[model samples]
Target chain A: MLQQYFGELETGLLSAIRGSDGLVNPRKLYSLEVARLGKRLCSGTSPVAWCGITAPFDLLHSMGVTSSFVEFVGALLAVTGVAGAFIDTADQAGYSSDGCSYHRAVMGAASQGLMPEPAFLVGATNPCSGGLAAIECLARHYSRPLTVLHIPQDESGGNVAYLAQQIRVLAGFVTAHTGLPLDRDRLREAIENTNRTRAAMCEMYALAQRVPSPATSKDLSNFGVVLPLFLGSEAAVELACAYRDEFARRCAASPTTKKRETFRLMWIQNRIQFRQDLEKLLENEYKAVIVVDELNDVTWDEIDPEEPFEGLARRSISIPFNGTMERRVEHLQKLAREYRIDGAVSPCNWGCRQGTGARGLIQAGLEEIGVPVLNLEVDCVDDRKYTEGQVRTRVEAFVEMLHGRSSPWN
Target chain B: MAVPPADFIGFACAYTPLPVIAAAGGAPYRVLPMTESPDQAGRMLHDNICPHVKRILDRAIDRDLPELRGMVFVNSCDAMRRLYDAWRRVDGAAPSVLIDLPPTADESAVAFFAGEIERLARTVESWCGRTIDRSKLSKAVEQHNVLCDRVDALTRRVEAGTLEGGWSRLQAALNLAATTPFDAALKHLDGLLGEAPADRRRASDPPIFLFGNVLPDPDAHALFEACGARIVGEDMCTGSRTFTRIDSDSTEDSCRLLAASLLRRPRCARTFDASDPGRMSQDVLDAVKRSGAKGAICHTVKFCDPYLVRLPLVREALQREGYPLLVLEGDCTLRSMGQHRTRIEAFAEMLR
Candidate 1:
């Protein structure tokens, strides 16, 4: 079913590209790349690995392993509307429904033999504990070797070295499974590609900071976070470059585009993947443009290829979700100031203990900077719990409250 | 010279080293979940967080806990980390230190965790307004080790079906050790052990091995016993995990030894064994084998991701070994646990 879905998506994306007279649609191209990855995973031709969201994809890709985080499959199952069945399978198997739906879906898929069996599993102690647990379960289910990167909360010198050493150990673990040694040149190339992707994404985010923001909420919904799956490849760099050009064009043409820009909002954490109506409702009815996403910013500097492990370690630890709440709030405040957001919307993704766990702190932090926040107590993946009407009412009330405030644009 | 009243340092996770807190001139007070607290933690943290964390936070928000001089938290899992985050916001003036605990027990991780423990020692010393004496720390380690030895002996009795007051008494003693001062807890444990009947053995009840993250409620254990099962052993953070002896070398650095010893314990689900992915399930199997149990029971808290995610494999491992496994999920409440009485009875019946 996954193969067929991705195959159809690849075909549909190809048709859209051809029909557009070969115009480079970054969104379509990005989808095509992901579809190809999905097909490759389903094909089971390459050595695959199931990893946590914060695992160094570049390192894995450099070692000739096809890897994607378990949540990617969870999100895929969710958006494709088959997550409910998988979640039920997991639920019936005694997995708690109170856990993250993303993991539940993946575990269910694994139980149903829907997930591609990987040669090994890599779990990272960042982002969330649920992801690590899911990875461990997958490793146990498939009878595969597992390597866990214990990403530290404090990004001190010793912590960074600890993580870097773990990354090296991870590479060793991968090599033991795949019988492939770590190639220095390939790692260097992968790091270079990652640097290029980061540079383009930084440019894209800069262009998105325009008065009438070029990017739409739909344009970059989960684009920044998911792009890392393709980080070590030329495709990631291309997708990023295309996004930068697209944002640049939109920014240049913004003055006469007749785009409604009443409230420039900041979307916190991940947007809902199973539905499109929320973004449309916020954009069309209220003219509230999501100027930035919490994860869209480039938080780390360029990686030095010579010291790739150290650089990757720093990047992984520097993610807002990995560290203390203060660090996450500080990053959110920076984004709020840069994007000049009127208000922030925190979906407070249900069962997400790491991200939604800090919902109160995030709200308080933003409000401290004179920005109001609307926390939608909704599940991003499990649509079963999402009441659209309630979400619409809350969003509308939030927008109304924002409208009552004095506009900086005026 | 008379010892002054011990300043109480509140902690949540079992990963927080009690000896370090004791050495820093503070009584290690484990803040456990209580059903009496109001549901106010959801306002600060998400409602779907681990019930243990939420209840702890609720206690803090409601000011239902005792006067704590400081707080120590371990970055053991996401829920614990969020609890630390929420605790700081709810009680900003209290001196709190969050130790970055590594999930793996590798050498590098041990070293890193040792540094974190050392950092914790400094912060705790500052909070207590005195430097941590190495001799005092060594003595604390020795005392804790002796306490662990006594608990192990009592645990052997529990496993051999010879424990005097059964699992409830053991759980109560463990809870006392967790919540009270080191000397007082040790004394209580010694008292319990000295009074325990040696020859009387519970032979008819089904011997069941229990495992999960945290099951601090002694009544829950009593419920299992009432349901016609004798809990031979448990691998919970509040039980065996907390009581695992810290083998200390007086010549070695105490913090490093403590870090090593804590990591070496039968790991919580939050800790991963990279070298052996199947070690967690195997650990359960080993415990079950040692206890001579006919069945296994896992009592995990609601919204506890670490245990919830790994439970299927545990069930599979037990099933492969021809052991019936019963998993019970509770919201850190006796009422939630009460709902599982029929199921536990059925499981106990099947084992018999």
Candidate 2:
């Protein structure tokens, strides 16, 4: 069923692109690339790995592995409206409902024999313990080899070397499993691809800071976070370039073509994958556009191909979510200022301790910078407990409150 | 004139090295969650976070805990890390340091963790206005090792079914060691061992091995005893895992030696053995067999992802070994354990 779903989605996306005379938007390209990756994973023609979100996808792609984080599968399940059944399956199997729904959905799917068997598994101990726990469970259930990267919170010289050594060990482990040796040339090329993608993303994000922001809530929803899965491949570069071009065109377009931006907002953490109505309500009803997302910024420097492991290790540890709350808040403060954010909406995603755990600190940090925040205590994946009316009312009231206070930009 | 608060350094996780704090001229105080604290942490943290962390944060928010000179936190898990973050926000005046503990116990990880421990020592030194004397650190390690040896002896008695009162007594001793000064706890242990009674468990009470993240409530253990089950073995943060012995002679540097010893201790679910994904379950099985347990009971706190995620594998291993397994979810309160009374009774009966 997953194979057929991906196959149909891939075909439909291709047909849509072809029908539009190859005038593809970044969102369509990104979706098509993800669909293709999904189809390949289901095809099982190559080595497939279920990894943590912070895993080095570029290196995996360089090794000819079809790898993506487990959360992507969960998001796919949620967006397809079939996550509830999987979640129920997991709950019945004695998995706690209090755990992250994304993991629960994937675990449920794996139990139901809906997921493809991977050759090995890789986990990273950063961002969230829940993610690594779910990955370890999957490794045990599949009876496969697992390599966990112990990402330290502080990115000191010793810490970076430790992580780099582990990444090298991971490369060896992947080789031992898939019988594909790491080619330095291929790895260099992959790093080069990532550098290109990062440059394009920087331009795209900067263009998004325009007065009538060139981006929309749908345009950047989960875009920055999920784009890393394709970092080593040309798909990521193309998708990023398309976004940069689109944003540039929007920024340079005539006044009438640009969308009215009454209030520019920032989205904290992840947006709800299954629901689009909230974005529509914010855009149509309140004239509030989410111009930036928490994960949208280019935080790391360009990876030097000569010392790729060190660069990758530094990038992995430098993610805002991996380190202290002070570091994350500092990053948010910078985003709020650069994006000219009026107010922020933090969807304190249920069961996400890494992101939502620092709810009060994030609120306090933003308010310290005179940016009010609205925290919606709702699950982004599992909508079973979500009350749409309550969320809508909260968002509308937050927007009204923002209107009462003058914008910081003014 | 009012006296200044004692030089107490509060901590929450089992992974915090008490010897370093002791060497730095501070008292190590393990902060356990209390049921009496109000549910106000939801204002700072989400409602779905681990209850252990929430309750700890509640005490900090309500100022229900004792005054401390400093706090130490280990980056053990997401909830624990959040507790550190929330605690710093709630009690901004307390000088605190968070040690970054590596998840894997590899050589590289051990070395990195040793550096983190050294960094922690420097932070604690600044907080206490004293240096961590090497000789003092060795002495502290020796004293901690003595406590561990006594705990292990008591644990062996429980495993042999020769110790009276089973887990409750052992838990009380461990809790005392965790919260009180080392000398005071040592004195209490000495008195308890002097007056220890032989096993008086009934034949109908099945021996069970228990495992979880945190079960600090001694009443919860008494509840298991009331349900007619003898807890012969346990692997909990607040129980056996807290008393890991440090090999002071392993390395010249006290911090490195402490790091190596702590990393080599019996790992919790939060620490993963990547090379052997089944190691945790196998460890539980081996411990259960060593204890001659007829069944196993896993008591994990709700929203504790580290333990909750690995529970099914542990259950599978226990079942494969012909052991009946009972799983209980709680909120670090005796009330939550009380709700599982019937299930525990049924499980004990099934084992019998």
Candidate 3:
């Protein structure tokens, strides 16, 4: 029943995005392509590989495997308001309530057979422990071949070389399972496509740092899903171009002169993708806007097509969570300074030890640097755990504190 | 606090290279799970991390670490990797290193692990301010080999129903051995060996194989005993898993021998060989068959991802082999033991 609801949601959204012609706007077209991919994943076709976002999708794409991140499915359920039941199912299936909601919801989905059996499964040691653990259970449940990428905590040369070798091994593993060798040209093309998307994302973020902040949080809520899942596709580049152009148009407009662009805030980790009025509440009630987030920026350098495997390996090892806590804190500080942000918020998503575990340190560091941070304890995917009244009160309090020091009213 | 001459290098997982630490003139200390409030660690790490990690960090945060030269962390799980981060943030006295362990033990994995061990050896040598020459490594291997042999021999006696107490006694003894120097561990085991066996055997007490995190207290085993069951064999991180003997004859390359033995040892949930998905479950089954056990118990710590994630599959595999499996979760507390006692006693009754 849950999968059917998602299936209908995808079909409806895809139809609207692809009405008659391709799309009236490129932005809708990108979303339509993404929805199409989501629908296909829900369709439970063979040759699909359920993977973590940190896994090398470029190589999977090169091997002709339909790679879908489990988190994406969890987010979809959250968006469609069907995640509560699945979260309950997972809770009943012995998952700890404190585990990340994203993983639990997907684990629940798998338990109910809402998720299809995959040809294989791939996971990595990055971002957090929850993803790998969830994938291991799913792999075991489905009896699929599981490949786990172990990224070193530190980004030493030896570690990079080690990961690079693993990426080479991953290609062989995928080939052995799928009987399709990764084409060097195909991987290079994927890398080049991803580089284009990264360039466009840079353009969008540059526009976003303006005084009025061109983009809304809702507009970019799906940014996390698109970049990690669709980076190697043409739609990803088109999506970036759409965001860049829309933000540029918004920044160059004339209606912002009379209104107050009161406060600019940065989101840490992932946004509350389920809330319909969250961005509006911040914008209208508090006059604060989430100009950027942790997931919005691309710290990855331009992928070198000449060395596709090494480039992907370098990108994999370079993830902020794969490194020290200081790296992530420093990156947030830089984002704060560069974006001219007043405050920051971390949702401290359940079941995510990597992001939530570093929250106190991050808050302390940001506070030391003259930026007050609110560490909100809320599950990102499961709204059953969300108390909107409490969240609003805390967020309102945080906004008032920011206003007391420097108000947009003045 | 001044560093002790025999500065023990604190390690978390069982798969960490203990023999190498010994080779580099440091005693390898396996941090066991204990029931601690973790108030200090909670101030640093979130309270929701696995209880085992929380307890380990609690010890560090409360300044409960013994005089140590340094710490060695393995990339075994996410919680452990974050433990290293939190340790660095606390600015502890001892320097730390993370050993990047591969998931599989293929040829490439062995080569990578050997290199990692050599790097660890270099780090330890520098810390102790002494060159661990080939002779020192060889001597350490020989000493460690004898300790392993002793542990294996003791474990065999217990499995064969010759020794008297529950497996918890063996677990506690191994815990002491893993945390001390070679000779001290042997002496402690010798003392246990000197105790004459009592005829405590019962045909109705169903023999069972046990596995998972460190069973720090004997209360768990005592509960099993009360439930009319005895652990014929254990695959615990602190039990038989630590007793595998390496090839002491290959003294020319101690690192290679250590890496090989680490692979050859009974596999843990955290250390996946990847060549076979059912290999770990099969090994546990083989151990169960070898010991003539009727059932198995996989006791795990709360939020322990490595063990918890693998439990369902291990349970399924074991059940398919006509072996009843019970998965008991706890935080290594007396209360958790009580909660598990009812379920354990019931399982034993069902087995009977």
> Candidate 2 lDDT, tens digit per residue, B24-75?
8788888888748789887777777888999988888888777777889899
The DockQ of each candidate is 0.77, 0.76, 0.43
As a TM-score, model 2 comes out at 0.96
Candidate 3 residue-wise lDDT, A259-299, digit = tens = 64578888888887585566788888877888788777877
B-chain TM-scores per prediction: 0.95, 0.95, 0.92
lDDT of 3 by residue, B1-352 (tens): 9744576888888778777788777888877766454567776667667777777777777667777788898877777877887777765647888787766677666777877888888998888777887778877877877887888877776766666674667767887898887778899988877778756667787888888875667667777788777778777765666667777654346787777778666677766655455456677778788878899988877767666656656666778888999888777666787888778888888888
Q: Share of real contacts kept by model 1? A: 0.86
lDDT of 1: 0.86
- lDDT (CA) per prediction: 0.86, 0.87, 0.76
In model 1, the runs with Cα more than 4 Å from the true position are: A408-410, B1-3, B157-164, B196-202
True-vs-predicted CA distance for residue B274, candidate 2, Å: 0.8
* TM, chain A, every candidate: 0.98, 0.98, 0.92
Better of 1 and 3 by TM-score: 1
Q: Which candidate is the best by lDDT?
A: 2
In the range A179-284, model 2's lDDT, one tens digit per residue, is 9999999999999999999999999998998787889878988987899899999888989999999889888883853555788899999889785599889998
Clash tally for model 1: 0
Say which candidate scores most in DockQ: 1
User: What 10-residue stretch in candidate 2 chain A is worst by lDDT?
Assistant: A252-261
